[model samples]
Target: MLELLSFGDQGWGDEMLLAGLMTILVSLSSVCLGLLIGVILASFKLSKSRILKLIAEVYTTVVRGVPELLVIYLLFFGGSSAVMYFAKMFGYDGYIELNAFTIGTFAVGAISGAYSTEVIRGAILAVPKGQFEVGETLGMSKFQMNLRIIFPQVARLALPGIGNVWQITLKDTSLISVTALVEIMRQAKVAAASEHEPFVFYTTAIVLYLLITTGSNKFFNRAEKKFSKGFVIEEST
Candidate 1:
C-alpha cells in the first residue's frame, strides 16, 4: 500500500500532490472573495438606512439557512445557464463557460461570506462607540476613519472567527468533487476507485488534510500573536 503512494510512474504521488495544491489554491481564493463580500455585507448592516440593513440581514439569513451542498449544486448547474442568458442579452451568441474551479470558489465564497458577515459585524460593533466619536471630533473623513482606526481593530478582533471560517472554507472545497474540479478529495476518490483500496487512499487523504489544517492553524496563531503584541496585559493581583 505504501509503495502505491511512492513517487513513480506506477504511483499516484504526483497526482495527489497536485490535487492538494489545487485544494489550497481554491480555498485561498474562496476565502479572499468571501472576505470581500463579508466586508460589503458588514457595511450594509452597519449603515443607518433600514432598507440596506434589511437587505443585508435577508442575504445572510437566507444563505446561512440553506445547506452548502445545495449551494454548490445551484452554482454548478445554474451559474453557466445564467451567464449564457446574460450574454444573449448583450448580443453575444457564445456560451460564457465557467469551469468547476470558478463555480467552486464562488459557491464556497458565498457561504463563507454569510458567516463572515456576522463575525465582522460583531467585531466592528465591539469597538467602543467612543472610538468613532473621537474620529469624528478629529474631523477625519469616513474612509479615513475606517482605514486608520476602525479596520485595524476589527481585523484583530475578527481574526479568530475568520480563522475558523477559513478552516471551514478549506474543508468545504472537498464538496466541489461533485463538480469534478479534481481537488484532493476527488483525486483520492479516483485513486480509491482505480486501485480498489478505499481505506488506504482515503486514509492518506485524511492525513494530508490534517497536515494542511495543522499548518494553517500555525500561521493563524502567528498572525494573532503578532497583532496582539503590546496589548497583552500583565494582570497584577
Candidate 2:
C-alpha cells in the first residue's frame, strides 16, 4: 500500500495529486461560468418579456431534466464538432480541438448553471420589493441598484445554495473522466486497476475528497458568518 503512494515510477501519488488539482481547477471554472450564466438566466426569467422568460424556463427545465452523464457525453462529442464547423466557416478547419479542460469545465458549468438559476432566482425574489422602491426613490439606476443593493443580498441569500452547488460541481467532475480528463477519481481508478490494490487507492481517494469537502465547508461557514453579521433574526422558542 505504501509503495503505491511512493513518489517513484511505480507509484501514482504525483499523478493523483495533479489530477486533484485539475479537479479543483475544473470545478472552480465551472462554478464561475455557472454563476454568470445563472445570473443571466435568472434575469431573463425576471424580465418583462414573455419570450425571454419562456426561453429561460425552457433552458433550465431541459438541462435539469437530463442526466448529467448524458450532458457530458453530448458536450464531449458535440463540442468538438461544433468548434470544427465554426472553424470551417472561417475557412480554417484543420481539426479544431478543444482540450479536456475546456470540455470538462463547460460540461460541468452547463449542469451547475441549471441548479444555480433556481438558487439565484429564489434569492433575488427573497429581497423585499420595498428595497427596489427605496432605490428608485433614491434615484438609483437599475444597474446601480443591482450593484449596490440587490447583488449583496443575493450573494448572502445564495451562499448556502451556492455552496451546495459547489459540492455537486466537485462531485460531477468525476464524470469528466469519460472525456479523458485525468481527475482524482480517474487517477485512483487507474492506480487501483494497475496495482491490484483497489482498496488502498480508493480509500485514499475518498480521504482526499473528504478533505476538500471539509475545507470548503469551513470557507462557506466563514462567508456565511461574514454576510449574516449585523442582521438580527427572531428566534422562536
Candidate 3:
C-alpha cells in the first residue's frame, strides 16, 4: 500500500493528487457560478411579475426534481449537439467538442443554483421591510439601500444555508466522473483498477472528501462569527 501511494511513476499518488485538485477547482467554479445564477433566480422569484415567478418556479422544480446523474448525462450529450446546431446556423461546420470539465461544472452548478435560489430568496425576505423604510428615511437611494443594508444582512442570514449548499455541491462533483472529467472519484477508480487496490484508493478518496468538508465547515464557521460580531440587542427601557 505504501508503495502504491509513493510519489513516482510506480505509484498512483501524483495522479490522485492532481485529480483531487481538479475536484476542488471544479467545485469552487460551480459554487461561484451557482451563486450568480441563484441571485438571478431569486430576483425572478421575488419579483412582482407573475410570469417571472412562474419562470423561476418552473426552473427550480425541473432541475431539482431530476436526478443529478441524469442531468449530467443530458448536458454531456445534448450540450455538444446544441452548441453544434447553433454553430451550423451561423454557417460554421464540424464537431465542436464541449470539454468534460465545462459540462460537469455547468451541470452541477445548475443543480446547485436551484437550491441556492430558495436559500437566498428566503434570506432576502428575512431582512425586515422596515430596514428599507429606514434607509429611505435616511435619504439612501434604492441601489445604495440594497448595497449598504440589504445585501450585507442578507449575506449574513444566508451564510449557513450557503454553507450547506457548498457541502452539497462538493459531494455532487463526484457524479461528474461520468462525464470523464477525472476528479477524485475518477482517479481513484483508475488507480484501483490499475493496481488492483480498491480498498486503498477508495479509502483515500473518502479521506480527501472528509478533509474538504471539514476545512469548508471551519471556514464557514469563522465567516458566520465574523458577520455576527457586531450584532447585539439592547434591552428596552
Candidate 4:
C-alpha cells in the first residue's frame, strides 16, 4: 500500500497532491464567483423594480430546481457554443472554446450562487427597519446608509449561510470530473483504476476533502465570532 503511495516515479503521491491542489483552487474560485453573483441577485431581488425581482426569482428557481449533474452537463457541452454564437454577432466567427476548469467553475458557481442569493436576501431583510429610520433621521443618503449601516449587519448575518454554501461548493467539485478537470476525485479514480485498488485511493480522496472542509469550518467559526463581537449585546436581567 505504501509502495503505491510513495512520492516518486514508483508511486502516485505527486499526482494526488497536485489533484488536491486543483480541488482547492476550483472550490475557492467557484465560491468567490458565487458570492459575487449572489450579491447581484440578492440586490435584484431587493430592488423596487418588479422586473428585476422576477429575473432574480427565475434564476434562483431554475438553477436550484434542476439537478446539479444536469446543470454541469449543459454548461460543459453548450457553454462554448453559446459564447461563439455571441461572438459571431460582432463579426468574430472564430470558435470560442472554454476549458474544462472554466466550465466547471462556472457550473458550480451558478449552483452555489442560487443558494447564496436566498441567504443574502434573507439577511438583508432581517435587519431592523429602525436602523434605516435612524439613518434617515440623521440625514444620511440611501447609499450612505446602506454602506455604513446595513452592509456590516448583513455580512455578519450572512456569514454562517455562506459557510454552508462553501462546503456544498467544495463537494460539488467532485462532479466536475466529468468535465475532465483532474481534481481530487478524478485523480483518485485514475489511481484506483490503474492500481486496481479502489479502496485506497478513494480513502485518500476522502481524507483530502475532510482536511479542507475542517479547516474551512474553523476559519468561518473564528470569522463569525470576530464579526459578532460588539454587535451582539447581552440582554439585561
Number of the predicted model whose lDDT against the real structure is largest: 4
Error of 2 at 187 (Å): 0.7
Model 1 misplaced regions, further than 4 Å: 233-237
Q: For candidate 3, list the clashing residue pairs, or say none.
A: none
Q: Report lDDT (Cα) of residue 202, candidate 2.
A: 88
Cα lDDT of model 3 by residue, 150-177, tens digit: 9999999899899999999999999999
Q: Against the correct fold, how does model 2 do in TM-score?
A: 0.94
Clash totals, every prediction:
0, 0, 0, 0
Q: Which residue ranges in model 2 land beyond 4 Å of their true spot?
A: 233-237
Better of 2 and 4 by TM-score: 2
- Error (Å) of candidate 1 at residue 139 is 2.0
Total clashes in model 3, counting residue pairs 3 or more apart in sequence or in different chains: 0
lDDT of each: 0.93, 0.91, 0.93, 0.93
Of 2 and 4, which scores higher on lDDT?
4
Q: What is the lDDT of residue 103 in candidate 4?
A: 97
lDDT of 2 by residue, 53-141 (tens): 99999999999999999999999999999888888999995987899999999999999998999999999999999999989999999
lDDT of 4 by residue, 19-111 (tens): 999999999999888989999999999999999999999999999999999999999999999989989998998978999999999999999
TM-score of each: 0.95, 0.94, 0.94, 0.93
The alpha-carbon deviation from the true structure for residue 105 of candidate 1, after best TM-score superposition, in angstroms, is: 0.4
lDDT of 1 by residue, 23-93 (tens): 99999999999999999999999999999999999999999999999999999999999989988999999
